[model samples]
Target: MSKKVILITGASSGMGKETAKALIQEGHTVYTVARRIDHMQDLKNMGGYPIQMDVTNENDIQNVVDTIIKHESKIDVLWNNAGYGLYGAVEDIPVDEARKQFEVNLFGLATITQKVVPYMRQAKSGTIINTSSMGGKMYTPMGAWYHASKHAVEGFSDCLRLELQEFNIKVVVLEPGVIATEFGEVMLKNISQFSSKGAYSSLTNQLVTATKKMYDKGQGSKPTVISKTVSKIVNETKPKTRYRVGLWAKPMVWMRIYLGDKLFDKIIMSQLS
Candidate 1:
């Protein structure tokens, strides 16, 4: 396989960092970015370029793209992976907070994609890998805003794939379920702060306990699972438009599909009970 110049966001840790390391080891020129640049010094030490970037900031996104193009002359792949999970009851989460969720998880990804697409289109060949979640396809209690943002990503990526087909830019969505990352800590933190003493207090407590139990028991798939998926998909000439990997991703999606709304709702709520 030819060594491709790649740009991946949210690369300070977790799946993004792992994938960046794997790609660099394979001899690809990789530019990794996140809001926390210090978290990525190890990646820089491994021959990957690390940049401090906030996806919500347009100037930061533009600068990262410009820097990559200046050095590599072209970008062969863009992995839009910079996102966080916000969990709380809809009524408990302020409108501004909800908007911020969309800004990071949906709009930010889109803005970065917009910046990179022109370069890919000019070259007539490139890949855009978007990191979504099984939550995009399924839903859980007290997670309305988070799921809404991911759902938007699913729709946005689908439309983008159709639009970019003529340009030969492949758009792929990754739906990972229960990866063992700081995702749980971040999510629990947000939920506890927002709903720990509201109408949703009981639900919040149950969610926190259940989430902790799941993670403590090591139910989450390792981050390497997703990193390997990134490696495999980039090598494919005609990769699938969407990949549902990691533990429970496929089954949860299947359950949501085959079961009616009432049954699926019961199943999901039972987990919190």
Candidate 2:
């Protein structure tokens, strides 16, 4: 494979960081960005460039694209992987907080893509990989906003795939299952703060305990699984429009598809019990 210039967001930790390392190891010119540039020191040491960027900031997004274009002339791949799970009952999470979730997960991703797509169209060759989740396809308790954002990502990618085909720009969506990242911890904190003493406190407590057990037992796949999957996607001449990786990702999506809403709800609720 030719050495291609790649850009990845949310590279401060977890899947994004792992993907950056893998791509650099493959001899690609990688520029990784996240709010925490200090966290990417190791990536820089490994010959990958790191930029400090907040995905919600348009100026930051513009700066990142301009810098990459100025340096590499063309970006061969764009990985939109910056997002966080906001876990709390829809009734309890303030609308402002919910909007913030979309700002980072959906709108921010869309903005970055908009800035980069023109360049890719001019070059007539590029790949755009978006990070959705199993939750995008299936709903879970206390993740209303997060799931909605990811579901939006799925639809967004589908339409973009069709539109970009003429331009030779590929749009792929990644549906990651449970990966051992800061996700569990951050989610637990949010749910507790938002709903622990509210009308859904009982369900909130149950979910909190269950989530703790799942992650504490190391049941989630390692971040490297996603990294390897991304590497595969990046190198494929004709990659699938969607790739599902990590533990429980495939099975959960399947259950949601075949089991119907009532049965799927039963299974998910049974877990909380």
Candidate 3:
């Protein structure tokens, strides 16, 4: 709202890209970074700077942060949103795949945050919004590694929030539910590639069928929903520590919170395969 400098990762598509557009429209200076720099050309057209970055590469992360600082002096908000869904049974998913999943979703998120926090701390005023998922709060049957990474994000944010309170730096956890992104498609592909013909074929198929039904029926919310959440998180003077948006984010979290793990699992498994 105040023409602040904002940097968002995974801005090549989905909520990150949309949020960059929204923030620029509101007069903020936005630098959107992702591996697919070509996909962000449209963002550049909207007066947002698009930087090519692979969050997994420490050199890329350092260079990106240094470049942003050289130009902007300070970053007002950092959105660590670049991640993909890695869905499969833990037993079926290889150890290497599990490690890579954490590398992207959890470790990468932390790496970018580490680079930015020093700048934010120097300012003594900044917000770090980590894009976690409803999976962080709840669990699903074939999403062991994905869920594990998000849950780590939730806890990681909590600790960072507590530690940074003295510096006036805010760390907010963003939990998006079933949003209309290629995330589901990617998840399906991962399951099919990693576990489709394995011991969990029937279960993965059931999960796929349920997810397909949801996507086919246009049940997922637009990326704009989460874009609006991003705007609110930045604009609010006192944003919540956690904000859950998109379809089913609230109800599913409610089931987990009130119904207890056993009942929640029963309900979710019934809906899946």
Cα-based RMSD of candidate 2: 0.6
Q: At residue 2, what lDDT does model 2 achieve? A: 78
lDDT by residue (1-273, candidate 1, tens digit) is 989999999999999999999999999999999999999999999999999999999999999999999988999999999889999889888999999999999999999999999999999999999999999999999889999999999999999999999999999999999999999999999999899996889999999999999999999999999999999888899999999999899999999999989999999989989
Segments in model 1 whose C-alpha atoms lie over 4 Å from true places: none
Clashing pairs in 1: none
Better of 1 and 3 by TM-score: 1
TM-score of each: 0.99, 0.99, 0.98
Task: Give the alpha carbon lDDT tens digit for every residue of 1-273 in model 2.
Answer: 878899999999999998899999999999999999999999999999999999999999999999999998999999999999999999999999999999999999999999999999999999999999999999999999999999999999999999999999999999999999998998999999999996999999999999999999999999999999899889998899999999999999999999999999999999999
lDDT of 3 by residue, 104-189 (tens): 99999999999899989999999999999999999998899999999999999999999999999999999999999889899999
Where in model 2 is the C-alpha error above 4 Å? Answer: none
Decoy 3 TM-score against native: 0.98
- lDDT, model 2, position 269: 94
